[model samples]
Target: MCVCTNRFLRLLIEKLCLPTYCLVDCDPYGFDILTTYRFGSMQMAYDAKQLRCPEVCWLGVFPSDSEKYCLPQQCFLPLTAEDKKKAEAMLNRCYLQREVPRWRLELELMLQRGVKFEIEALSVHSLSFLSKEYITSKIQGGVRI
Candidate 1:
């Protein structure tokens, strides 16, 4: 949300043609944040081209990750009515269907499963597990989407 940071990042990405990755919680708000980074805010439509990071990749804390990583039961949080509604609404967005159908399917799967988790949930294993294993493996293995 910091304009300075976004401007700096945008300049860096432009000059270097950097590949960007986004890691957010597996929740509607988190998803919104990721989209904001990739698509830019509707409020700032005037400067979207300067701010948006089109090459950004979704990096972690996907919904299916709960079962895949075997996060403890304590880490799973049931989606509220608001959460379900938000996810369902997002599912209808054309960008998801056209540009990232796999991402949309994962979002749909999240709604069907009725659960959410945070990046911190990965810490249930250990701090190093994220940097050393999950992130390293996902990036190296090209599993990020």
Candidate 2:
């Protein structure tokens, strides 16, 4: 489950009925990874719906969370040209507009801010900060979609 490859996830989705929650870095690549998990990749277009876990919701490390959680400024990294290109391509995906508008908004915010951070950024305060506080609070607070 750590990786979001469509072939493997297709099998997992077919066999499981549980909800899936995605926790990824607050970056274009990470956002793309989440999209792949929930929407499947174009390369696997024929099986996209079957592979996609539409029930999957993004659990953060969102760009906005860096400020919300007071993560160190040093943890934020500027988006490279390649990151911007990837994000722009993702922005054009039709499923984003039709299915996950809120997630799309978050991706837009990341592009607007031009910055990204890793899940490990939450650990600036403490090694267990993500597990003990971030993830727990986001889940309990119903902060996914």
Residue range 1-145, candidate 1, lDDT tens digits: 6667678878878899987888899998898788778778768889888888888889877888888899998998999999999888888877887887778878888888888988989988998888898898888988788
Residue 128 shift from truth in candidate 2, angstroms: 0.7
Those runs of model 1 whose alpha carbons end farther than 4 Å from true positions after fitting are none
The ten-residue window of minimal lDDT in model 2 covers: 1-10
Determine the backbone clash count of candidate 1: 0
TM-score of each model, paired residue for residue: 0.91, 0.89
Prediction 2 TM-score vs. true: 0.89
Question: Whose lDDT is greatest here?
Answer: 1
**35: Cα error in model 2, Å:** 0.6
